[model samples]
Target: MDENGFWAMIEAAWGVAGGKAKPRQRLSEGKLSEGRAYALQEVLEEEVVPALLERLDALSADELLEFDRILERKLYDIDRADIQERTDGSDDGFLYCRGFIVGMGRAYYEAVRANPDRAITDAECEQMCYLSWHLYHDKFGEMTPSGISRETCSNPAGWPPDSKPDAAPDAAG
Candidate 1:
């Protein structure tokens, strides 16, 4: 796939793996609200990781390495502590969780690629993906019930929060 297509696939895969929300309920007198934490936990543990590993097995050694590099870049690009802080705020928590998946994705991809003679299957991939996702959830906790609010969050900020137009170099004499 082309670079754009590849990243798109990654984004789409993440979306599918992220799953959908359930119906919301009203907060009544003295009743506490519960989120979909349990369901999300189960899905992550049961599905996503395995799918990823299966995909990895289908690739050639070189292709697997390429996938590993992509995942590694993603992991390195993320700010771990910031992700943890945002876990309470938005889908940044899911983005953080993606980091762990990326790590396992890379490792398993490399492992299968390095040993091409070994057989790997879709079921195994799904298991790995599920395991990775669950591990992330367990370590990080459920993503905020509000889920990730991508609408307000910037993937990359335009400038440092403290910076202003005054910081720019003068263009006019």
Candidate 2:
């Protein structure tokens, strides 16, 4: 799927998992506690995940890979120290936090991307990161790595080469 289609699925999932009052409203009002985060995750897992799986099930193998790549890019693009610090998690936890941001849909994702301070510290959506992998394994009996790492600080462009202590200096100097 294309970027728009990818985001549309996310948006739809968010709508389903939102329940009556809407999760974003709670997010905006700063009501996201650890308990609330877990509650939201539960709803997403129960309702949205099966829906997402059904949608992914219909895609051709190529489209599924494309969707995974787009998800990797989205997660990669948000892999900044500023965002991670705000979210406050372990390496894997940070990855899930980023997935939570993407699962919130395009508007919230863009908001957090533009301003890391907008991140919610308590929320996570780990399942969103591995949907394509799960489907690919089920369908083909094999899973190819996406070549991009979804872990925090893994994107060179987002993290910057100079920011890494082990980075090599310019050879021409």
Candidate 3:
């Protein structure tokens, strides 16, 4: 739930990715190692490899919204100048971070659906659905009820099915 937790997860994922044991460090105790800062340059296309699995298991399933909030900040509040400086304007970091946040929401929905014992509030589910659609549309260049249906259904078996259409919708509505 803090930057140390975030950096630790980042370090662990990279360590695993490179075929080494995850570097488990107490990031809360001090600054992140400058060593891993170098790897950020090598991240494919500069995309921040989101530590999704790390976050999922680190916190209880019911606290997914907290995860969502973290992603929200990372995606929305990311300093453009900082990312540009870090990755030389590749845009990979920006795209990846945004997608990663949305991805976490999607993962949470699927994970919770598969195991309902750690259920989120209905409002949280709806927020996840909205966030999913918003991000999907942002990346995919189109938004439709069908797109939302794929993700935000009571059950995955036959979701977003022929539900009643809203009276009207506008581009910004």
Reference-based TM-score of each model: 0.37, 0.78, 0.31
Can you tell me which runs of candidate 2 are displaced by over 4 Å? 18-22, 25-38, 141-146, 160-173
> Candidate 1 lDDT, tens digit per residue, 1-173?
33444344443443457523231111111121234333433454455444455455555544544454444344333322233232223333334443333322333223323332211111112232233234434544443222212211222332244321332222232
Regions of model 3 farther than 4 Å from truth: 19-51, 79-94, 97-173
| Cα error, candidate 2, residue 65 (Å) | 0.9
- Sort the predicted structures by lDDT, highest score first: 2, 1, 3
Off by over 4 Å in 1: 1-34, 88-173
C-alpha local distance difference test of each model: 0.34, 0.73, 0.32
lDDT of 3 by residue, 1-173 (tens): 55445445444554545522221121111233434423322341122233335344445432433444444444443222322232222233323433322332333223323342222111111222234234444445453232112211122232123431232122133
lDDT by residue for model 2 (50-80), tens: 7777788888988888888899889989987
Better of 2 and 3 by TM-score: 2
Better of 2 and 3 by lDDT: 2
Best by TM-score: 2
- Give me the displacement of residue 124 in model 1, in angstroms: 19
